[model samples]
Target: MAPQVDITVFPGNIVNNEFAATTTTRHAINPSTGEALPEVPVSTKDDVDVAVAHARTAFKTWSKVPFAERARLLLAFANAIEENREQLERLLVLEQGKPLGLAKMEFDMGIQWLRTFATMEVKDEVLDDNEDRIITQTFPPLGVCCGIVPWNWPVLLGLGKIGPALITGNTIIIKPSPFTPYCDLKLGEIGMKIFPEGVLQVLSGGDDLGPMLTEHPGIDKISFTGSSDTGKLVMQSCSKTLKRVTLELGGNDPAIICEDADFSVTVPKVATMAFLNSGQICMLVKRVYVHESIYDKFRDAIVEFTKTVVKTGDGFEDGVLVGPLQNSMQYEKVKDMYADIKHQGYKMALEGHAMTNSKGFFITPSIIDNPPEDSRIVVEEPFGPVIPLLKWSDEDDVIERANSLKMGLGASVWSKDLDRADRMARELSAGSVWINSHFDVAPNVPFGGHKWSGIGSEWGMTGLKGYCNSRSIWKWKKVM
Candidate 1:
């Protein structure tokens, strides 16, 4: 028999601050070991109605609570999450299959973000003031928000929606990815005790659940993180109800290495950035363009570093630099991509094949050397641990190639020459361009995409606004 695991987090969905059981439920599998972990409730269309109706009712009262008190409760929830860090971290690693360090960091980041929003003050702006008249701008909450969290970073992504939505007075219902729903459901369990009934909710199920929530007339908005294809569908679903939508979608990000970059500093940093989370991050460096003058040196340096840096295994084990792929759907996708690369006779910097021994979804971190620019691995997002290194001599040529995709999520420019890197970063067709660094996000900074990656923004004042509607207030005194 498989070793027993905890299942206390479920039995039913929480509605009106209490457990409401659904007859059906589903079990989660440990991505690293392929073992059944726990059975969680599979909520349904009726559950969506109950959740949204409760949220709509709660929003009436929640919107009236003092902003400062709301912030206090949010911070208190953050504290609660930290206090339960050990349990949350274990589930995160079990379902998500990221290393412990990464799992811990993601949870920590979520806590930190809640606190950041706690301090943020979105005060009413006084547009004009005089004896005869006064004008002010206020942002009122959007009611009944549904945050659809992706599997890759469920804790962080789920909290990314929770913190802002609640702090800004919008009640939230989170739909976590089926493959990684444990932590999110647990977070909902935590929220139930701390927040007023219906203020925060989590519903865990497969494909059909999303459409039900999105199409519900009671839902006011949706904040989603997933593939560009699904994002388009989310937009279509919400369109019928005219619900507001904020989407953070796919990325085929690029990293430009100018001739001036330091090989020692650049190689290892880029290697980590490229393969972190097994290259599942939407912002992870996908396509790399190196100046021909330093291309060979850069490629060799990266290969040496990759050998020393990566060791795939279970997240709980010691000395494991990377963990297994999060689920079988993504596992098969990466498997097919790797097979194609082999069949096409691409050169692998790290000689290996897809992993099979551990009963887990695992793949070796791979880098292709000088593949044709038109290759599938070069053009499509493998969304796994494979990347391509291409050479370019002309600045104009490389920039054009990088911007060729319909997606413009993120890009990076690396050079010891500050001016050249800045110029290159400016021209790169991406929403967030980093000069030397990659994937660093702050709560106070606005982050999103340009073309196909996202709609609207998250974080900063703009992020807070995304959850609200701007209402202009006017007061005038009669002159007698």
Candidate 2:
């Protein structure tokens, strides 16, 4: 039986293994109905200072604890999350505007990530082992980490940063997006039962809290996941203190469908990536490039598939695969893009459904058919359920166009010929490239971005290294 956790109960900041209330509070809106849910506490500068001081104090012992013991505690934390999975899933759907099914997937993946990070160990590298002298290198954890998690996939991304930082012996204070902070706060509450006081904490606030944490001297490192523009600001802020930073920013990813691609299989896969989670994912496929030879067939097939298969409504309603945009700001931005699409006289191949006189920030999925390469929908990432399908007659030209963007987070190629697909995938300048698949991510893979996409890695060994400092030790065996 599921735990009787109240899905409607709003939580405050988790600092020093306790719930800390704030003088100011804000209401979290339900994206499904545009109704206010409950009051979420907004942390102040004092809260940050207190949290940081506690973390610094806790780091003294947490960093010295045996790695095996840390692993055991992390596993216990994962188990606690599993026990309250149903409550977390419902909270995620209500706050993040994703289907309950996707929320469950996110929670499951988050648990798996914690387990994976627990098993990983950073061993010392021996450079020399001579009789006269010995040389070795080791990784020491940074003092205190600040993980700034975005609203999209809050559970997975939050754990992505928290797992590596904690496993590598660094204490972290998570600042969840105000748009979706309930589940993360609850996560912090759950973690407090397993981890030591101040080892893992969460602070909930609005725009002001982010700058306070990022610019705070107490924070040794900042792992930020957000838009490219905001990432630039974060990098600039961290530069002032020379703090280590790992940024996983925005992406305008492209998917190239080769002439020999299997239309039946490729079309649905591409559509899923383009429309899933209402296309709010940073690494989602925002642009589709189809060879001119079969562009028409691929376009028509995707349109028909989206119309028949994709459902849009409240997440609680049965068969609703797509929910409203997580917030009103994003809803207005996508609406502006829609207006621009009309002004530019672009043809929409499949406008799934018209916008209704609804209360929530809802938008029906739409596909732009063969928009110009430089068009807004093609060049800029909508970050919504709108995708642009373009025609490409030449492989070289298509690859060039795909690589032209400054944001190279993830890309995919679809082709029956393994050699052809592999060759094309190699040419795309993205952190994660897939052939005949899209959005295939794992906890063990080192996922980051190229160019303006991001600065550091998030998962795998590279991600763990991001939270630590390298030190070389030279020992003299004989007295000199």
Candidate 3:
């Protein structure tokens, strides 16, 4: 059963700012319990239009603010996020079902990014400085951006887009995933109080709202993080207006364990990487390329490790290893993938399934072993935590197999030899490569993908670039 969200008369910005389209508030549920949460307004297309209009209007004044002042405001926003971390963290856990600790970590990770981008300064450079002529360049914000954030790490991705966009002086309308909207709506309410009305706005509701915002002519850019299929839809919607777009799409990231690698160490880590968040992350190790020599040992260790780590329950419980799948569709997809691979004669070391009579959609930790290289389980990005092991003979062969996918968001190499690991890291096609490590990310570094993983980088200085357009200035000492 879906949880009910209460919509009552609030009679203020939460209502009026909803663009006066609908008065009814919708319930956000705990995916784990199917229980109603404090309701947030479900926005209408009119609300989306109003949010974009407000952002466009705000851009006029916001774009003129000195870079330093803009940075200061972002810093203030970051501080506020840090101060309210506890409240925000709980809200995220309630809606998203990420373990409480992991939820808190995700929140802080985004805060780190906000702080980093806020303090970062764009240094001016003279393009040409010959005695006869000189030229320069400056990076400036695109007027109004529509940020489409995924539900996986809501706050982290939301902050990733909002922090850079605002610090660079672009007013933005954020469209939170309908699966989880309360946190973003709450974020908007607080953000509006901190910044001006038009500086930042949040749109919460059904799928139609995303298309409306992305396709709106007033939007100058679209920053989206979600599945590749949906990313295509977003790009198509933005095509008519030719809005600048940056997409961080799906990934079927591979982890390579060379012959010399220790199965004892790598297996346990791989299980965590594969199953964490119940396998919802784009960069989760969906495919494993292991040498034949240690295959059995590696497989057994991973099964054991998975059994130890996964404890099914609500996300708030301490020592809980796994939580409910974000929604039923995702839950069904994971099961379908499991069945598809099973039909291909792959042996399952572990299989995922939802608990009976449960409020939230759930799946057990699963390990699908040695499916045909061409099987959907191996070829498609199973955003669920089921890992398919593919054995390879050499480094070149492993690299070839890993890069065979249409996606290339992230990958990692696990080997004891530093030289070999680094060599393989250089060969893997990914935006970020982890050597003997799976999921560590930093706000100060750049992350995105090659091929179809994504269109532009996010985080660090590169992330800021996605929100801006470069303007070249030429001062000819002698005019032609």
Candidate 4:
């Protein structure tokens, strides 16, 4: 059953395994119906301090717990989430505006991710093994980890940080985006049963929360997922503390549609990635470079496929594939971009449509045809259900064009030729490149960005190390 719009309210910082409500609060709205959902407390700087202090105190013991015990508890927590998946997923949908199916996927993926991290282990290395001296490396926990989660897929992204942080023996304070704080905060609440007090915490708040987490002395590391502009600010802020930072920022990812591509299979697959979550995903295929010979065919196939599969409505409604955007700030941004497209007379493959006088921030799928290379729709990320298809004649030229963008989070190349696709994938500049796929992330693989997209990574052996500092221990025996 769908949860009530006015479901139970949530408190502020979860410090020491208890909810602490603050004086200030922020109201979360349901984008599908424009109704205000539960109001979550706004954690102030003081609240952040409390959470950080508790995390620091917890680290003393958490970092000392046997790895087997920590992994067992984390796996137990993941199982618990699976048991409570339905209710948690409903909570995510009410706040995040993703369709009920997508929200449930987020919860399910989050649980799998937690288990993956729980099972992940890295072996210590012997730097040197000689008769006279022995030196080895060990992974020791960083004091405290602060995760700043974005709104689009908060459940999956939030747990991305939590799993790695906890498994690596660091206590974490999760600061969920005020736009969609409910599910993440609830995760913190759920974690209390499995984790020790102060091991897991969440601070929901307004503008002040981010700066507090980045600038504070207590936070040892930070993992952020958001816009490139905001990521720069986070990097700048973390510089003062010299804390380890991992940022998964914005992307203008391009997908190369090779001449021999299978349109029947490719069109629907690309359509799903291009417009999934209304194209709010960081790795969505924002640009398409179709071979000139097959450009028209590919474009028409996509348009036809979109017409058949695309349906925008309230998240809970049956047969609704797309839902209203999660917030107004993003809605206005995309709305303005569409205005510019119309003013410039760009040839749109399928014109956009909006809700009729409804307060919902709903926008139908938009496919702009062959916008100029320099146009805003082509250059900047609109982060909406809007995509631009361009023509590419030569693989070399298309490769250059695709790698031209500054954001290199992810990219895809579609082709039946395995050799060609494999070679192209190697040359792509993005951190993750897929052949015949886009935005296909798993818990075991390391996910991150290159260039302006991000620094460092998450969700692998590397990610586990992100939450820890490597220590080299040495022993020298006297000549016996």
Candidate 5:
């Protein structure tokens, strides 16, 4: 039996280990039902000031705490999250509109990230050790950090920033997207019990809240995950104060199906990547370039696989493989793209189901049958359950087309020939390239974008170093 979790009972903004309610509030909509779940506090400039001030105060002591103790506490925090795993998973489904199983997976990924970050340490490097002189390079934490999380994969992405920021001895304030803020607020509520006052906080609000926090002088750094256009805005805002910024933005990642690829195995995987998270993930494969010889077979197989396996409706429904778009803005955007595809008269191999009768913001999972290279569906990211299957004969032309897009977060190659796949993967312009797999990320591996997709990396030593400032120490044995 499933747990009877009531998502409405969650708290609001958390500052200094306490709930900070606001006079103005907004309701978080349940994308599955097209109804409001519960009221989340709409933070104002004063709320931002309070949270930042608390974070600033906490950083003073947090930065001085020993690394071992910080790691221990972080482990304890991860344990606490495990204790409330079921509740968090249920809440995630209600607010984020992902299947309950996917919600659980998100928690699992988040918990692993926290645990891995706890074990990671940025050690000092000895550049020169000699009789006459010794020089070393060390990483020191940057002060108060603000993490702005997106609607999709809120918990996983939220923890992605939180784990590294706190483990590196920096105090952080998280601002979750208003569309799906419940889990983040609940996380903040849970954190208060384990962490010291102001060590970790979450503030929920509408659009204005982001600029309030990003432009504030108190915030030393901004770690943002959102669209490329919005990421550009964030960069501009941070430049006013010259705040350190890490932006993980959009992606139109491509998946190349080589001639040697097995359609039986590759089709299912490519379809899954294209439609996962309702096609909302930044790193999801948005375009597919199939070798001309196998293009027709791969397209037919994928269409059949999607029809047989992909189920959509409310996320809580059993065996639901996809869910509604998390908010109205995105739902409308995807609908517009669908209309455009129709207006262009592109052949749709598989148009799963009509959303007209559905109550929630649902769109039919669709596939374009080898559309024109410059078609809207092929050129722009639909960010919904729609994908373009393009035919490619020349390897160089396909590679060029794949890398032509401005956004390059991730890409994948499907080929049984390991050497061929490796050579092709190396040529693709992306932060993470896979031979046979997609969306394979780990805490120890660095992940980021190569172009407009994002700036700076997340996870691993490189990501961990992003939270700190490098310092070099030079000492002389004798007055040199």
Candidate 6:
């Protein structure tokens, strides 16, 4: 029997004020069963205005609070979230359809970001070795920021934006994706307990409330994470106001399995990384490039491994390796891509199979053999359980080919020669390079892309730069 998960709707807050009452109703459906778990109230533009107004007023004082005080409150917020992580994890599993363990791990990592960023010290010092000279670059918040996060990993992504923004002394208004707004709202409530009213807020709705949040002059900066298409739209929207923006966009990450690479090692790791989170992760290995010598063996190994590792079932099951697609649109898209690739003459080493007795959006992991370099599935990101293999022999040739894509988010190299793999990783045109690993993220380490993969970094001291305006201060010293 599938686990029974229930959601309780909490009213979305436009303004971060004391919660007097819950006065709205909307339901978030569990995509696996197609049942509404709980009804969460949707916020409108007026709500966003109210939220921003409160934050704008709060910024006057919040920004003045000593950096130490702000850091203290940030740690407090992290503590509150940590205490209720299991409850948050349960809700995340219900709405997002990721495995329960993965959800919990994500929550933990999100808290780690909060803790790490809270203690980050921005210092000012002398620029020269001169004994009588001084220079400083003090960090200051960008007033009120609007954080727009996607539904895939709402808690973690939201923290990636909010953690830096908040610790830097900026008040925040988060507009969470409608697909999973409950967790955002609940997290906001927990934040309010530690933070002063208006320091943090959550607004929930479809796409309607985005314009007001981004275009509002009161919002000093915007941090967003989602598709490149959406990132473009947001960039245009924020342009008119000329607001500061940070965007973490889409990725079609490619893994190059070299001729000298061990198939036994690369095949299994790439297969798991490709389909982790049901291939919903932006950095998930979307395409695999193998040398022709090992293509056949790599294909067979990946196909066999994917079959055993990924399970087709509702998300609520205990041992389900992969859950439903989280929505019907994604389900159709994955299925369509699989069919298209097969029709384009690529062999379907593994065909995607839908569930026979369930209404949930489940699809089997699929592998396409020797797909053309320019094939639709190879060029485009499926963002689903589909892996299309491409063949390449010359290292120089393949590196040139891999760098061809406009999306330079991430890449991975697999080989027994660590030095060779490291060199390739450095040469790959990507913001992040992994040797023998994929989907590895840490809070202290910066993450972003060079080309269309993203606009700016999202975590670490570098990420804090996005939420701040850098000013170099110098005092002219007179030698009398």
| CA lDDT, every model vs. true structure | 0.87, 0.90, 0.80, 0.88, 0.90, 0.81
Q: lDDT of candidate 3 vs native?
A: 0.80
User: What is the lDDT ranking, best to worst?
Assistant: 2, 5, 4, 1, 6, 3
How well does each candidate superpose onto the true structure, as a TM-score?
Answer: 0.96, 0.98, 0.93, 0.97, 0.98, 0.94
* lDDT (10s digit) by residue, model 4, range 1-480: 211222375755578888798997778888877888877888878888788888888999999998899999998888777777788788887888889999888887998999888888766889998889999999888889999999999999999999999988899999999889888888887787779989999888887789989999999999999999999999999999899999999999999999999887789999999999988999999999999999998899899888888888878877777788789999989899999999999999999876657788999999999989889998999999999999989888889988888989999999999899999999999999999989999988998998999999888888788887999998887655
- Worst window of 10 by summed lDDT in candidate 2: 1-10
**Which stretches of candidate 4 lie above 4 Å from their native place?**
1-7, 477-480
RMSD of each: 3.0, 1.4, 3.8, 2.3, 2.0, 3.3
Which one wins by TM-score: 3 or 4?
A: 4
User: Where does model 3 exceed 4 Å of error?
Assistant: 1-21, 478-480
lDDT of candidate 5 over 134-190, digit per residue (tens): 999999999999999999989999999999999999999999998999989888887
Model 2 Cα lDDT, one tens digit per residue, 213-247: 98999999999999999999999999999999999
In the predicted model 1, the residue pairs found to clash are none
Task: Tell me the TM-score of model 3.
Answer: 0.93
Q: Which residue pairs in candidate 2 have backbone atoms (N, alpha carbon, C) closer than 3 angstroms, thus clashing?
A: none
* Residue-level error in angstroms, candidate 1, position 402: 1.3
lDDT for model 6: 0.81
Model 4's number of clashes is 0
* Candidate 6 structure quality by residue, lDDT tens digits, 272-331: 788877888899998888988988888888888888866766655776667777777777
